[model samples]
Target: MSQAALDSLIRMAPVARKSAAEMVVEKLLELIYSGSVKAGDTLPTEQELSAALQVSRPVIREALRGLQILGVVETRQGGRCSVTDLKPSRLAAPLQFLVGLDHDNVEALYEARLTVEGELLALGAARADEAALEHLEHMVHEGHRLTTDPLAFRVMDLEFHHTLMRLAGNPFLERTAQSLYHIGAEVRRVASETPGVLTNSAREHELILEALKLRDPERARRAMHTHLASILRTTREAMQQSP
Candidate 1:
């Protein structure tokens, strides 16, 4: 098929017929994927979009705001809206919020982290540069220095993994990593508070950084697996002890 025809089919694909807000979101996403609205391109004003789509201005604004929150759109002063290169990390806040409200289990978050971080670590080992490796080492060192403070160690741990993801040179992986990291933040906070958890995490960080610096893919993968296993074990034990 011609490229143009393929584009048309994608744009015209059936979307879930849901509430008006959802439909608006779908249509905007279609426009983005079809390149009718490229990144950085200005969207029609709320008034213009309402008129063109035959929807109310308030409806348009609401839909736009939702998209903006999703990192799909950027609204600036003077009411201008532009397309954005939204990343999965942008979903972290909403996902965290929803998961938090639902009393979701940490096991699900751990599963996701294991899968995404394992993949990211492999990619990072293959693609990381001197600068990225140096950053990773620095984060590990900082994490070690803060081993006495579980809270600070947890933050440093998150940064360490995030830096690894950034080194992978894949935006999708980076975003997935961010979401998993965000979801696990609370669990990590509690785990870090446990006696000896921070020290163990710091040691794991050192091992992972050493593997990365060695550029040994297999060792790096093993280090990542070992680190996650420790976390899972500690988290399960902690949950069991909780009243």
Candidate 2:
């Protein structure tokens, strides 16, 4: 702990008779969001937080534990903890859990992705830099080569969409899409095994990539819309026949 760490605790007003553990979590989150505590900065020790926040060590302990689970912070050996990297992808863990818990959510997830990813594709087309375009081109080209290999093609499909989302330059949107991507992996795995699906996906991916390479937002958006529409239709039929 440093003098700056103490100053952060001093700046925040004390909790006013609320649940100590929950309040501690809130205050810590505030500190992180306010930039008082940053990624790679070690949090003040249990004794220090307890003394400064005027909360019991037990309450702080519980709060820290909860934070660890939420990916807000990580606890290391020897009672040390630090703020997490704060990536939106960190949220994938929770989303993965939710996805596994409910079969109905699979369709809802795909529908949500279809709605947002169309715009993301357009945005990516108009905004993706040269390096980003090249990256996407590589994936699309390699994906074509793997059309006959379902397993390899499946991995490339996810990577292609993930790269496409990141190129949209919206970290928040990219992260959300990533969560859906994780869930969709299973859905895609099943779909990829179907006859002619991979070949069609490879064709669709090339169209989507070409639109981006041409820097045509309208083309990119329409291409993605057409691609996802077909996927959704396939998903519906697959679900009906699924046990």
Q: What is the C-alpha local distance difference test score of each model? A: 0.73, 0.80
Which pairs of residues collide in model 1?
none
Q: Which candidate gets the maximum TM-score versus the true structure?
A: 1
TM-score for each candidate, following the candidate numbering: 0.79, 0.73
| Model 1: per-residue Cα lDDT over 16-36, one tens digit each | 435766777777777777776
Error (Å) of candidate 1 at residue 32 is 1.9
lDDT of 2 by residue, 15-99 (tens): 6567888889998888887777788788888998888888888898999987877788887777699888888666344566455
Per-candidate alpha-carbon RMSD to the true structure: 4.8, 4.2
What is the lDDT for 221 in model 2?
A: 86
| Stretches of model 1 off by over 4 angstroms after superposition | 1-18, 85-94, 101-105, 237-243
